[model samples]
Target: MSGQLFVIGLGPGNASQVTPEASHAVAEAEFFFGYGPYVDRLELRPDQTRIASDNREELSRANAALQRAAEGAKVAVVSGGDPGVFAMAAAVCEAIEKGPVEWRDIDLTIIPGVTAMLAVAARIGAPLGHDFCTISLSDNLKPWAVIERRLEAAASAGFVIALYNPISKARPWQLGSAFEILRRHLPGDTPVIFGRAAGRPDERIEIVKLEQADPAKADMATCVMIGSPETSIVERAHKPPLVYTPRFSTESSQ
Candidate 1:
């Protein structure tokens, strides 16, 4: 009897953010398949199998997990943030379609969790409160020229940009290029917030002038939030601790 397969979301970085249902799913699974760093977060359970590796091995790892499930092992394919939100859920779904795995009987569930996009938006007050669009600046899976076109369109249309996969160890200039596209259509003083290792150790969240967003501070773990003209930072206690971009205000009509 092929057992159930779960695609569970682990949330950003904090274990505390893990839902009780997610913990239960993890405990019940005979195998936990996830990114290498995510697997390290859970305390080692001897009876539970772990399939973890670098991002390059994700396809293979996902295939192995599906194979195990086909063989009737209860498997949990884990991802940081909502599995369906720029995570491994789609991989598991696509692999099942192409592989020999029998999905007809294998119960598959995608459990949702807090995504970095929403968290970063909250930290910056409400840049996302208005109409916004999300785009990944990475070219590894998608072409760079396509990304440039989309960036241009989004900026021209006045949509706040939530850029994922903004930068990493190898592709450093992607974000800079994206910024350049935005600068052509967006105001230079527009607010941009960079969230580094958000909710994790070495966490650093800072707001900077749009022109000053450094690519060096980013990695695969970071999420970049670019505000529309409406975003503004407010002062708090002797410091500016807040930002907000209202969807619409009478002030903009003048």
Candidate 2:
């Protein structure tokens, strides 16, 4: 009667982004777990038991989910955006690695979904056309010094940044700190997008200059995208803001 544990990704905000695999995984689950905000994203049947909590308690919640699975409850541990990308997958893995639950034979799977980085990239018209990398500015998991080194490396390497977990109530200055470091490599005119709750009802996309990317307007639900040096802000006469990053073919060598 051993049950399977699924780290299901719910995508950004809308139920429309939910993958068929993820949907099927949830449909088969007897129990579910995820962040409080993302729990509201689903329309599950009444029989499915759900565990919801804030980001601060994500690890504890995930551990409890695994424990439930070990106790023979079919389970799904949910996460918004992509589970493997700055979400609950790693946390679940780490918890399992720590041997908190003595059961080592439990079934575990990581289901992928569309992330906010790709969603925002689509909204801004291929700012990720070339090379790019994603990094979270939060120092809670990793050292701030290590994150700074990554930011500097990404900047010098000309990799466009898809910054997750940019700012929150407690870590208000994290984004600003990374931006200050990136500005040294990227020009101040580079396009920076503030995407709030991407794919949700209150979703907002603000295109601001690098110098004016205000961290005050950001929170855990937000994803801040900073483009590379070649990233262009092309404005058509009537169309909305369009971001274009040159590909190898598009770039003309002198």
**Weakest lDDT window of 10 consecutive positions for candidate 1:** 245-254
- Tens digit of lDDT per residue, candidate 2, span 1-254? 56789999999878888899999998899888988878777778989887788877878988898889888988998888899998899888888888655646789988999899988887779889889999988888899999999999999888889998898777888888888998888898989988887787989888998987787777877888898889989898988879978885443464
> Pairs clashing in candidate 2?
none
> TM-score of model 1 relative to the true fold?
0.92
Query: How badly does each model clash, as a count of residue pairs?
Result: 0, 0
| Model 2 CA deviation exceeding 4 Å by range | 100-102, 249-254
lDDT of 1 by residue, 1-254 (tens): 78889999988878888889888888888888888888877775889878787876667777888878888889988888778877788888788887773665688888888778877766556768778888978787789999999999988777888898988778888888888888888888888888766677777888888878777767878888888777777768976568777868433433
What C-alpha lDDT values do all the predictions have? 0.81, 0.86
